[model samples]
Target: MTTNQLVEQIKQKKSFLCIGLDVDLNKIPQYLLKEADPIFAFNKAIIDATHHLCVAYKPNTAFYEAYGIKGWQALEKTINYINEKYPEIFTIADAKRGDIGNTSTMYAKAFFEDLAFDSVTVAPYMGKDSVEPFLAFSDKHTIMLALTSNAGAFDFQTKEIDGKEVYKHVLETSKSWKNAQNLMYVVGATKAEYLADIRNIIPDSFLLVPGVGAQGGNLQDVCKYGMNDNVGLLINSSRGIIYASNQDDFAQMAARKAEALQKEMALILG
Candidate 1:
């Protein structure tokens, strides 16, 4: 989807919430196992139940990769279902992929052409050549890792180099890559304090923030420092929402969780 289209959805729904579909078979309701495809079954229910409450759906590819072929098939079915059923909803393949240029192009094609996700997360450690290939696709976004929410982020992302932080350099350097306008970033919600400096470098770019609820990142603080004129943020809550309950009412429980976040976003937007 286009940036305007994504922003329009956020406005129409009064939300910028990005629900993560990181399904774990161990955590899902056992009753779903009777289905022909439990993974897709679980995802379909969550999507149906919570579609209206959020602007985006992100399926972390690792969950599917773990299940091997079955996992990949389920991911295909999930993305196809979303594209056919809810074309306006921005879909993210949270693959965190990055490699050499040729390999990166293939990765881009896999997610952008074959699976048809609106965006995909990528690592920037390999520099521009590795990430630019993904940015080459039209109407698609490449969300590169910046300041992540995980504890290990400080190990490299915040380290200094030539008087500037590594992530700051990543943010500034990425701005000059090919099709830079299509670039977004992954800034962890846990690092809300760093947003002011991040904004100084790329104020208009969208940020896919993961680490609210379950990770204990404060929503109010994220918006307070991270929000822009367009309210550029996709706050992700995965296990906290999807795993709200493992009973027959799991989907409804997920909806409730998502709705609460959406309501918070609505108030923030207002």
Candidate 2:
């Protein structure tokens, strides 16, 4: 989806919430295992239940890749179901992939053409050559990792490079790449304090922020500093919403969790 389309979805839904479909078989309800494809079954239920409460669904590729071929099939089915049923909802393949130029092109084709994801998360370590290939795809977004929420982010992201933080440098330098308008970023909600500085670098670029509920990132603080005129944030809540309950009523409970966040977003938008 284009940036305008995404912004419209946020306005229409009164939400910028992106639900993470990071399904863990062990954590899902035991009953789902009876289904032929438990992963897809679980995802379908959650998507059906909570589709309207949020604007996006991000399925981290690791969850499906871990299960091998069947896992991949499940991931395919889940993305297909969402595209067919809820085309309005943006889909993100959280596959933090990057490689040499030729290799990165294939990765872009895998997610954008074969899998049909609206966006894919990419690592920026390889610099312009690695990321430019993904950005070359028209209407498909390449969300580069910036300041992440994990404890290890301090190892490099925040460290000074040429008198500026590496993450800031990533933001500034990325803006000069070809088709940079299609570039978005991953900024963990846990580092909400840095958002003001982040915005100053790229105020209009959309930020896919994880680490909210489960990681204890304050939603209010994220909005306070990260929000722009277009409400440029996709606040994701994975375990906190999808795993709200592991019982038969799991989907309902997931909806409740999503609704609560959407309500909060509505208030923030107002």
Clashes of each: 0, 0
Candidate 1 per-residue lDDT, tens place, 5-29, comes to: 8999999999999999999999999
Worst 10 residues of 2 by lDDT: 1-10
Write one digit per residue (lDDT tens) for candidate 2, span 1-270. 888999999999999999999999999999999999999999999999999999999999999999999999999999999999999999999999999999999999999999999999999999999999999998899999999999999999999988999999999999999999999999999999999999999999999999999998999999999999999999999999999999999999999999999999999999
C-alpha lDDT (0 to 100) for residue 71 of candidate 1 = 98
Each model's lDDT: 0.95, 0.96
TM-score of 2: 0.99
What would you estimate as the lDDT of candidate 2? Answer: 0.96
Model 1: how far is 205 from its true place, Å? 0.2
Residue 45 in candidate 2 has what lDDT? 96
**Candidate 1 lDDT trough over 10 residues, lowest sum:** 213-222
RMSD of each: 0.6, 0.5
